[model samples]
Target: MEAPVYTALAERWQDQAGLARLAERAERRLREHPHGDLTRWRDALSRLPPVEPSADLDRPDPRLGATAPDLQGLGETLMDLHPWRKGPLVLGGIRIDTEWRSDWKWERVTPYIDLGGARVLDIGCGNGYFGLRMLGAGAELVVGVDPTLLFVMQYLVCRHFGGDLPNYVLPLGIEDLPEGLGGWDAVFSMGVLYHRRNPMRHLRRLRRLLKTGGTLVLETLVLPISRPGDLLVPDGRYARMRNVWAIPGTDRLLGWVNEAGFENARLVDMRPTTTSEQRSTPWMTFESLEQALEPGDGSRTIEGLPAPVRAVIVATA
Candidate 1:
């Protein structure tokens, strides 16, 4: 059977040019991927008893509970999909503490963009957490793209509880999207630019995905330097993350954005990541930000690089 998430998205976006093809390609890729745990995840998701989701997107808790009858059952089913990375999701009164304080990121982002009735695309959206928040902020539709199957499953669980809202997270990457298929009013590329091997290509692609005068909300790890050309090309990894290719300074980031054909790019916010914002919890038991930091200095990463400091830049496409 086709996943209800995909079916609903296909039906709703069928008339939108190029959306149907993208959805079809995403479905095909999902089927071909060898995800051995998909069946178990699906079973766990099916066990979640239906309840009217009470989404409090404006608050720190983006909850999905409302006097649920089977709180214990809901918690148990949610735990079956462990290592929750991007949430502090409250389901049936149980707080599934995630690895990252995605709420902090949301708080930093939501203030700058006008989501009202905007067609938004979230690149590398993990579990559709921010997408849900965008919907709550009055976005017309939110399309999140990420290649990870586990995150897709996690999103499915939220979708099931959140009801048939106009938000969809596809198991595909930014590269999977066709170029010049512009319609989105706002494009968000958070925690994703550093992971791209070619940051310029990624930026240009984001520009192509948006309509003229569209907003691009970009948040990524940045080096704490004042120079325009200074960028840290990690020899191997940055903060224990292997895929991080480049960490640019604020000026360098702006330069890149302007060079990528974006206009009026300006850094809006920059803050060092805190242990309080990200730490190991009962729901996410894996090594976290606290563990990733250097034991002696606490400011530098375990690899002796400058600690993770993120910057949010708003640009015009």
Candidate 2:
């Protein structure tokens, strides 16, 4: 069956000429690249009983629930798609304890952006959790882009419960977006820059996607140095994450953002990740922050690299 989420998305963006091709391309991609467990996920999605879409974005638990009596069944269906990473969502009576305390990230970021009636994009958005929060914060539209099919499925499940809001997660990446597609009021690139082989190129792409004087909220893993040019290029992996390419210092990160033509680039928040913020839970039954760290020291990763410290920077494009 065709996903209802796409239908809602098409209707929402039908009036915007700039988004026509994007919407079409997204639809084609969704149709062409069905995940191996797409049918199973879809079936699981269908089993979820209808509920009112009421999101509490300010709370630690972003909830969508009703007084439904079949919450046990709903939880079971949600469990079918496991390894939930970016949420602590409360649906019905079930609280999905995810791997990452994404709410903490949200708390760090929400204060910096003026989301009221803004058009926003979240790069590497996992499961559209933050996208939903954007909508809850009064954003006119929130379009999240991620290449992972599993995350897309999880987003669709959230969309099903959220009742056709103006939020969509396209199964694409920053590279998949057309160049010079500028119009968004704010562009967010959280937990994405370090993974890119060329972080400057990623920043430039992000700048290209925003309008004149638009804001860019960038959050990424960084080295703990206080200098401007220092950077750590991991030998193989950082904290068991294989794709991590470069961990730049805050000053170096600001330099890259400024070089990318972003103005007023400044670091807003910087802090190391903690076990309380990211640990294995029942919903995500795999190695987590606790397991990824060194056995004797919490400050370093298992690979003996400097432990994960993330920084959030805001700039004008």
Candidate 3:
């Protein structure tokens, strides 16, 4: 029932008392053979009896355009969805962006969100690195929502590592945004909105989930300026990419945040990511700074701005 119990029962049948007996026996056997396989040395662990799997793990909400994010049957689901990260795909000429690990995501990003003693919502929390970190750092409550099986499976692993047993990790999306969802102090979404078909719709939905004066912290790709006007995400966008709209400039981003019923919209930082990197790494995929900004051309998106294809936006609700 408890988180540790699952891992323990699944692997270690030796109880505390059994451990003591094993230790005593090992001490006695030390003179005979001190260094061999531990499995050879210990009393065998008995198999744990199986229990029925939770039906809720596979439950789907009605409105999400995609299927309920499958928390069950995830091993294969993840392999299919995350094909970029492994296997025979590696031998082909194709490259996968592998730089998802970051100096910022672990250290700077989580702390800046500041979830301590606060109710927090992490939209599309893939692998939930922030949720685990927030719980370890003392969040009063933390809820992570994501649409991919890979993200949910990783979240389940991370939660157990944080010590609380899971009730469930529900699959959810912008279309299924819960009613009466306010009263949270903060909402954090990073690198996820762009994947949606309607990013502005996703922005507006954040307002439904935040308390008055709550903050939304986001990191995303923005379009570099070609001239005085806004740039459209060129016409032939990928098929599975439903929305993939690129906010033309920081001004447009700030405008959207304000329109979404938020004040104090601001651009916090800018940096180059894997957008242009050869796609060997699984995580580093992004709208590369070079291609996005075309920095070499001495180009500016508008009259005053230097081209920064990606930007971080932090706004108050």
Q: By TM-score, how accurate is candidate 3? A: 0.57
- What tens-digit string does per-residue lDDT give for candidate 3 at 1-317? 11222222112223223323322332333323333332321211111112222211111110111122333343232233342321111101122233343324444355455655766777876645555455545565555565554444433332322334322233445454446456667787777766766767778888878888888987776765444565456343422233555545667777877888888887877554443332333333343333333344534432224343566788888
Give one digit per residue, the lDDT tens place, for model 2 in 1-317: 48534545545545555565666677778778857887887788778787776555556777765645787787788889887999888766678899999989999998988899898988999898998788878898888889987898888777666666677888888888876457789999999998999998999899888988999999999987643357999899889999999998888889999999999988999998999999999999898898889997988899988888999999999
Q: Ranking by lDDT, best first?
A: 1, 2, 3
The local lDDT score (0 to 100) that residue 252 gets in candidate 3 is 75
Q: Clashes per prediction?
A: 0, 0, 16
Clashing pairs in 2: none
What is the overall TM-score of model 1 with all chains considered together?
A: 0.94
Model 1 residue 262 distance off true place after TM-score fit, in angstroms: 0.9
lDDT of 1: 0.85
Local error of candidate 3 at residue 309 (angstroms): 3.2
User: Please, what is the whole-model Cα lDDT of each candidate in the order they appear?
Assistant: 0.85, 0.83, 0.47
Off by over 4 Å in 2: 8-16, 52-58, 226-229
